[model samples]
Target chain A: MFDIVIVGGGGAALVAAIEAATLGKSVLVLSKHYPTQSQTSMAQGGINAALYPPDSCDSHIQDTLKAGVGLAKEAIVQEVCRAAPKAIEWLDSIGMPFSRKGEAIAQRRLGGATYPRACYAQDYTGLKLLHTLYDNAVKLGVALRSRTFLLNIIEEDGVCKGVSVLDMARGKVEQILAKAVILATGGYAKMYGALSTNGFGSFGEGVAAAMRAGAKLSDLEFVQFHPTALKKSSILISEAARGAGARLIDQEGQEIGGELWTRDRLSRAIFEAMEEGREIFLDMRHLGKEFIEKNLPQERKLALLYEGVDPLKEPVPIRPVAHYTMGGIDVDENMQSSIQGLYAVGECTNAKLHGANRLGGNSLLELVVLGKKAAQSAAQMEQAPQQKLFERTKIDTNFIKAVFALPNQIDFWERQEFLSKIMYHNCGIVREEMRLKGVLSVVRQHQKELAFMGVRDKSPLMNKELINFLEYGNMVELAEAVLVGAIQRTESRGAHFRADYPQRDDKKFLAHTMIWKENGVLCADFKPV
Target chain B: MKIKIKRFHPHFEPPSIDMEYEVDNAPTLLDALLQIKRQKDRTLTFDYMCRSGVCGSCAVRVEGKEVLACQHIPKDGEYIEPLSVVDVIRDLSVRLEDALVTLGSSKAYPLDMQKVAMNEEDERLIERQSDCILCSGCLSSCPVYESNEAFLGPFALSRVWRYVADKREQAKKEHIDAVVQNGIWDCTLCGNCTQVCPQGIDPKNDIVMLQSKAVQFGYQNPNLGGFGSFGLEF
Candidate 1:
């Protein structure tokens, strides 16, 4: 048995693996795809670090707490902000190739920050950071198994024993016993599907599996809507574009203002405008072609390819789409979850860091700092003896066979598409009591209908259909929790905006939303901060 | 639009075949492939994650030229197939884990670099090399790796150059030594890797830069010899 098994291939898993390996512990990293292909690579903006002059960690923490709308844990905010410079140093030491100023790392102003504190490598910040981490992990001899899908976290008697996975390359069900398992499998913003600015693999399966294994999830309702995704494709146009002086314009060629506002406020304004039968556009033509080509090349490429509108020549059509999710498996300051020997970091865990909404550029920073923290914490624990127990989990070899043997009464793809549409309309940027209730019922119905959904392709090797089917099941399961959390919280706050309530009711709903399963039934409640 | 997919299934009857489908409202090749998988066929397999060019998982060959499936708008009756130089896992998905191992073997990252300040000019010198997405499109078009698998391909070589040019990296001599064998000198300067790089990273130029550095480090091309020494007795 390995000392630590990381269940995702993103930046968090790599950092954790490197840390664990440095601690001289046996570690294995499991990924559904190549390690470099994680959602972390798609982060175009930057990572926050208060290393520039006139910027202090106190200002960064205050900005983060303000963006979080009173739900951010003060202690966690301070810790992350204080650790930002050291994290940047470690990343630089490993050759992150961060864009440099005059003998210092280049800092840019992301939307929610008072100072230019976000260190970047132009617009390809995430890609460069992920590659650097992956290179370091490889150099440190971290064992990585690609094409391994995590089916379930094996928990026996309230302790995480191991994980059950489907080896996609070998076409077999395997159980990997581990002393500790770290979940870094990203967020479920893609539950909005075509209306999401997430990668296709961000289905929150790791969070769902953790919840099934008795991990308590917090704040599953706070889904951040990016203000400037391409209108037709929902592909993200980074906030860095606006930071570079691009303006948000209405169809009548008037500036809509709030270009530098935090994501929630800006997204709500754009949503309100779009609801009134008006279109919004991101005007980057004023930034000039050379500047666009030099700094925001990815944004230009995305706008041209997805929407066929060149940002250098014309205003790019844009809208707010589901971008980041602040809710996930709840973890303490040590990055340990409710289950013993089970830990979570990065986008998969709600560490009370980005409470109601995430500040721009903080996600990447959290991935680095907390990823190393989880590994260090997990390494100090006593090694659990290797056990032959794999039959306690809900999914196993027989479970896969049964799922494949089920009658195909419903088309999962159609149902998934239908669910995405309804979720995007009802439970999306704007919500109310009736629409949320409607979507909750639909989610409950879909959960019940999951039994009849079967994979048509019974091929064992590299069966993407089976993987998609499992992702759909996980999405349906998590959608129930999101809807229930949204319906229960009567007050509008942060990204969980309730149109019916219309105002922040911090008096009653200042606590966090907690969701878990009790005896195969989903349950929800609130935890006071 | 009508598109032809070169299909391959190890467990199927014939193992390989060309299938055509007419898909509506499919703007990109990825959309058309997903449409076929959702509506027409259930067994079609391809790999994609971000559906943008960043993740680099959706690179395939269209009409025998490597391109990212999500970024390339398809023409009518165009052919889509797996990358030519890699092992096909299924229909249009190629195995890249083996190719990625070279990133580690080539010592593509900085080693033992002292913490030093860097300027924007030094950062910009290696900026284009750092933009490589590791898409393997370069490897697929690389003529050197097509015949000799031991040759470090374009992406890996470009990454080596990324560190060798960085001011913060102190182990430039070790990096230059690592690429002297199958890494830099093995490349034929064919320019195919530069032609197919979606991110516009010129690995050929990076290889030339590495050659210059290698010579400065007193390592000559092993294939070269003194004058009048072309296997003739003096």
Candidate 2:
């Protein structure tokens, strides 16, 4: 029995684990994948922390709340903003090797920021931060469990207990008994077929588990689509493109808008433009080769040195992709979930700081600020005995056999291509009632077929097919949730734009749309953000 | 286009499967696989993502060596297979799960509040090496990885050495000690890793960086003494 059991090994879990360990608690950190192999590692931009002399906590707070579009919890925003500096300082202490300028630090501006306050260790800041926290957590004596899948949560008499996890390497399920549980399992971006900078595991399973355990979800309709993901790859073209003087142009070389326009507006414009056979391009030529080579060298080098298109010489094709989810499991100021002895942070919980849309770099800021908060709160809780254990039935060999025995002769490439096409065409950056409803029907029809499908590989180790099955299941479930939420919401705001309701009707839809699976059906509920 | 794939399993004698794919004007290797998976057959397995080459997902052997499926253009008739001497988890996807896991297991630099300031030269030493995407492209192209599964590989070493070389990080000595295993010492100083890296993060420089730090720490890989020269290209 452990004092604390953490699900998901993103920034939030590592921070919480380290904090709990520092508080002298015997803790365990379980990740579905390896700790650093998370969507957190895919974060190319910097963490937004108000550290520069020109930037202030107040300014950061205001920018965040404004970007959240009236639904952000003001108090929570203040709390996170004030605590953000400490988190950055802590990361620096952990040897993050942040990029600096002269005597002062320099920050590259991103979308929806009032000031240059992003603290970074070059482009892969999150990877660096994850490494730092993971190392610190190990030194402080947290049991780091990798490749462990959470089977289910165990509870008794309405109180939180331990969890059952499948240790993939051992090919067996092990139940971990803990006094408390922290779900830092990240977001549901993988639900969308096309993802910009999202990992294969960002399926929001932790949030799903929370909902299954009766925790209320908030702002489920608030999904943030990044405005500039490469079309074929969905690799995020950082918003720093706009910040660094790149222009969004139509195929005919006309400007879309002031490139610095907010994310929501940019996404809508691009979506509409793509409808008119006007593919979008990020024009970095005007910025000169020096700027491209100096600051944004990766994009340029990848274009010229690798992909064979010099962005300085020509326009690179681009589009919007599902990036972040502003909505998730409802957590309070201390990052405590509705359930006692449970906490969530980072992309897993709804602090409501990023209400409808998240500003660039704030996602990183939230990880540190809310992550520290959850950890600090967990430490203060009176240490209690390990909770009741759930009875573990033997692994269903027949079911496993059936799951592994499905025909691997089916063409997954066509199947996935069809799924992605429908998803991208119907429920993409722009959506309508007719299209979303059609998408729901299509998903319902295909879910069973997908379940029965088998992948070619049966290797006992790193079985990509089995992993894809699980991932596809997650994708289906998350897509269903999104459609339900999108269909239910009558008005458009932030990333959830509806062609049916072209305006933001705050009077009717000020509250958040929360959806949960009840008896195999999606049930919608409302919660104040 | 006719393609031959080398196939081997512990359960069966090693053999090569000859497959055919239709090419439509400048098809990528990924396109050929897509055609094979869709039109021809579906038993063949491979790893891929962000099909346009950014994610470093679809890596496989084109002829005798490794290349990214998404980026490498297919020849009219080519022999392709899983990477050489690695545990092929199905077809193209090797058991790279260990690479990420092993790196995670090695401890990172401890937290220190006071930063060690450095000039531009110190910053430039590591700034370019820090952009690794964990694609394992470098590992796939590595000649040494053929025999030793425990080799830290180019990605991890580059990353580990990135921290070791950073002037801002105070625990350079500790970092040096942590990465000495099949970690920094096993690097052959081959430029193959650098050539294959899609992100242009030369693991060769990073390996050199690690060697310099290892010299500073008075430690050496017994086979290759500290600060020894390997005439590496680029």
Candidate 3:
């Protein structure tokens, strides 16, 4: 048994691990992949900190609250904002190579930011911060377990005690006992399928596993669609392009709204334009070759490799794609979920800072500040002996060989693509009641298909199919939850847009929509911000 | 394009088999493998994430050349294999645990810094060096590492150089001394590691920089110390 077992290796996990280790707690970090290979490493834009002149954390909070569209909890926003500068300092202390101006760290104006407050290390801000934290976590002497697939959180009488994991490489299953377990397991944006900005492992497994353990989930309907992902491939083109003077052009090649617009507004505009068949283009060519080369090199390289367009020569074709999940397992400011001895942080938690839609660069900021807060609170909790031993029956080879020849491979993939298309069309940037109903119907059927088909792969060594199968199952559940919550919420607010009821309804729909599995159905409820 | 992947298993005869598959319209070799796995074979194994190429998880040897499968398009009749000089976990997926463990061996990070302020030029020098994704591509490709396993490899040496270049690193001597096996002088500087880097980090040059610093700290490869300076003696 360990003192603490963190279930993910992104920014949240490392920050928490470092804090716990410093407090003399034995720490174990189990990552599904290499810690640095997380989605946090994919964050291209800078992190937000009001460190420059004429800018303040309060103003940062104001921008975040505005972008969240009346859903941002004032207290949570204030707390995170207050901790933002210290988060930057923490990152620097760990050797984050931040790009600096004369005396202070440099800041660039992001989409929703009132001032130039995003501190960066060129374009690879997330990579810089994540790697630094990773090094620090390693230095803190925390034990790391990689390529371990988290099966579920073990709870006895509503207290999380440990986690069951499938060791992918060695082809074994193990029950790791712990006093406290932190689920920094990211979000379900990949449930939006291939068109999402998240990596392959960002399945809402943490939240889902907790939900299965009788934990309630909050705001499942709020999925933020990024305004600019490559046209052919949905790989993200960071909004920093706009900060560096990139423009969003309509099909007519005329500049409409570019990077200056807030994420929600920009996503909506892009979706509308895309619906009108006016393809959106991120025109960074006018920003000049020098600026694009110096700062936006990664963006340029991705454009050339993935989308086959040079941002320096022409406007790269882009459209709105599902990116961030604003809703997740509800947690307090201490980052403790409803379950005792269980914790959630990073994008997996509904920390209530980004209530409906997250601001640009704020996710990375929350990753550190909230991650540290969770560790501080978790470190004080008394360690209790397990009431029940959480154990897997066995790693059976028969279970891996369950896939049937009846469902052809092409047919299986087509179904997945179809389901993704449904999510993209109905529960996307713009939503309609009829479309959402159609989506939910198909989604529920897929969920049944997913459960009934216990289809799997035989080999246990690096069994990616088994991982994908589990992820698909989680995605199906999360997709249903997303649609169910979307269907229940009748008003347009933040990313939960309703075509039929195209108005922000504070009278009835101001609160959050929480859902949890009960009996055989997912039941929905509400909680005030 | 025809893709041939080398398969490996412990109990199996010959311990490896070359399996071929047909692919079409795939943007990269990683995409082709994904297609084959999803539709062709269910049990095929490999490591990958963020297939857009930054994660460096999907690295493999295509046509005997080290490349990120997410960035390389499979050519006609391409033979892909696991990264050489590393023990295989299964097939293309190999054990990088040792190489990855060495990433922290030099204490490359600023362990004792109090978040002190620094100028842009101070950071700009070590900027290119900090871009390592720890894919171990350089380690797997290097001739020196292939010959001498104790060489600390290019990534580790470059990591040490990243700290040595940093003004914030107070314990620079500990970091310099950590790269021991005459590590700085052992490098052949053949440019193989630099050529193989997906992120274009010049580890070869960084190794040379570390070598220069090591000599300044009165260290040299004992293997080469036998040869005296002929020109000065003459």
What do the candidate models score in CA lDDT, each in turn? 0.90, 0.71, 0.82
User: Which stretches in model 2 have alpha-carbon errors above 4 Å?
Assistant: A131-145, A164-174, A195-199, A301-308, A377-402, A405-420, A447-461, B2-90, B95-113, B118-120, B133-161, B171-234
Cα lDDT of model 2 by residue, B154-222, tens digit: 877777776666666566777777777767777778789888776678888878888877877898566
lDDT of 1 by residue, A364-385 (tens): 9999999999999999777684
Q: In lDDT terms, which candidate is top?
A: 1
* Model 3 misplaced stretches (Cα beyond 4 Å): A391-412, B114-117, B227-234
Judged by whole-model lDDT over C-alpha atoms, candidate 3 comes out at 0.82
TM-score of each: 0.98, 0.84, 0.96
Give the chain B TM-score for each candidate.
0.94, 0.78, 0.91
Per-residue lDDT of model 2, residues A383-476, tens digit only:
5645443553133223344566777555444565566667666676778899889988877766767655776656544444555565565566
Judged by whole-model lDDT over C-alpha atoms, candidate 1 comes out at 0.90
- True-vs-predicted CA distance for residue A391, candidate 3, Å: 5.9
lDDT of each residue in A316-375, candidate 3, tens digit only:
999889899999998877789988989999999898899878888899998888888888
lDDT by residue for model 3 over B113-149, one digit each (tens)?
A: 6545679888888898888787888888989889877
Instruction: Tell me which of candidates 2 and 3 scores higher on DockQ.
Output: 3
Candidate 2, overall lDDT? 0.71
On TM-score, the candidate that comes out on top is: 1
